[model samples]
Target: MGGNKVAIVTGGARGIGRGCALALAEKGLDIAIVDMLEPEMARTVGEITALGRVARWYVADVADHARAAVVVGQVAADFGRIDVLVNNAGRGNPKGILEITEEEFDRTIAVNLKSCFNFIQPVVPVMRAGGGGRIVSMSSLNAHSGGVTSAVSKFSYAAAKAGIIGLTRALAKELGPEIAINCVCPGVIETELGNSLTKARGPELMKGIALGRLGTPRDVAGLVAFLATVEPNFITGQDFIIDGFQWVV
Candidate 1:
C-alpha cells in the first residue's frame, strides 16, 4: 500500500522474479533482491533503482537457512522494515524417475520448497513487528495435475509444491490478522525454463491447454503484485492457479 513499503523478492535476477521486482517497483515499493547470480542480481538492482526506488541486491542461496537469515537481517537493517516477501526462487527436474539421481531430487526440493522456509522464517518476525505483511510463494500446476515424467520425479515435485500450499494455509492461520500468506500455481510460462521444458516435451504438450499458448512471466507477476498490495488484505491461505484453464477438459 503505501508508496514507501519495502519488499524482498528471491531469485529477483531473472525470469518471473525479475518481472515481479519491476512490477512491484512500478507500484512504489523499495526492493531488496536476493539471488545466487551476482551479475544478474546487480542488473536487476540497477533496473529497480532507475525506477526511483531503493533497490539492494544480495547474493545468497535461498535454500541455505543461515545465509538467508543473515541476508534478511541485512535487508531489514537497510530498509528499516519489510512489508512483503515473495518466495519466487525455484528449480525444475524434468528427468524420469529412473534417470533422476538422488542429488537432483534433493536439489529440486531444496530450491523449490526449502527456500520458502528459509525466507519466510526470518521475515515473519519482521512483519509481525511492523504490524503485518504479505507473503506469496510460487507453486506449479504440475503439483496438482502431476507431471508427465516418471512417477518418482513427478511425485517429488508435486509433493514439494503441495507442501508449499499446505505451508501457506497453515502459516496464514498461524499469523492470522497480522499477516497474509498465499501460493500461486503457474502453468507453463514463457520463461527460459518453460521454453526448454516445452521443447523437450515437444508440441504435444501444448495441446492440453485450451488457450493454446504458454503464459508469460508478466502474467504471473501481475498476480504477485496484486497480492502484495493492500487490496488483497482480505485474501489469505488460498492457492490461486494462473494457468490458461489448461486443466479444463
Candidate 2:
C-alpha cells in the first residue's frame, strides 16, 4: 500500500516503535529508524530487511534539536523522500512530585514533548516538498487518566504526553490538506519498558481491560499502519485510543 515510500520511526529499536516499523514495512514501505540502542536498532533493521524492504538505523538522542535536524536531513538524503514519521520515542518517570528532581522533570518534558516539535519541524518541509505525508506521535493513556496510583509513570509523564495531543491538534491544522497529523494514546502495552508493571499487576490489570489481556506492540502497530497508509483518508487532528477498552487503569 505504501510501495516505494519511506517511514522514519523514532525509538524504532524495540517495543512498540519496532512493531510499528515492521507493520509499516509489511505494507511495502522502506524504514529509517532513529534510536540510541545500537544493537537493538540494528536487529530491527535486519528484520525489516528480511521482509524485503530497505531499512537503516541512526543513533541519536531524540531530545536534541540539532541532532534531530541532522538525522532527518540524512534520512531524506538517504531515502530520497520522507513519507511517514512516527514520534514513538519516549521514557517513563516512576517518581512522584516530591521524589522527582528538577533535572528529571525537565528531561521528561524534553524527551516526550519537545522531541515531537524537533522532528516535526524538519519533516514538514520534506513532506510538503514531496507532495504530502502522514505523522503519528505516541501519546499515552496516562495523558487521559492521569496515571493510576500504582502506574509506572506519574504526573510529569502525563503532562508531557498530554502536551503531545495539543501538538498534534495544532500541527494538524497548520500542516493540513497536505500532511495528516495525529497521535495515539495506548494503555499498558506489553513492551520491554512496561513489562515490570505488567508482571507485578498481570492478573489485577486484565480484569479492568475489556479485552481481558494486556495490549501488545502488534496491537498498537496495526492501528499505526492503518493511519499511515489509509487511502482517501479524512482522518487527522485527532487522538485515537488503543487501550482495549480499559475502564480502569
Give the count of colliding residue pairs in each prediction: 0, 0
Q: Give me the runs in candidate 2 sitting further than 4 Å from their true place.
A: 1-3
What's the lDDT for all of these models? 0.87, 0.94
Q: What lDDT, from 0 to 1, does candidate 2 have?
A: 0.94
Score candidate 1 by lDDT: 0.87
lDDT of 1 by residue, 185-242 (tens): 9888888777777666537657878788878889999999999885746999999999
Per-residue lDDT over 1-249 for candidate 2, one digit per residue giving the tens place of the 0 to 100 score = 223899999999999999999999999999999999999999999999999999999999999999999999999989889999999999988999989999999999999999999999999999988899999999999999998564578999999999999999998999999999999999989998778678888888899999888899999999999999999899999999999998777
Q: Which ten residues in a row have the lowest lDDT in candidate 2?
A: 145-154
Whose lDDT is greatest here?
2
Model 2 / residue 185 / CA error / Å:
0.5
Each prediction's TM-score against the native?
0.92, 0.98
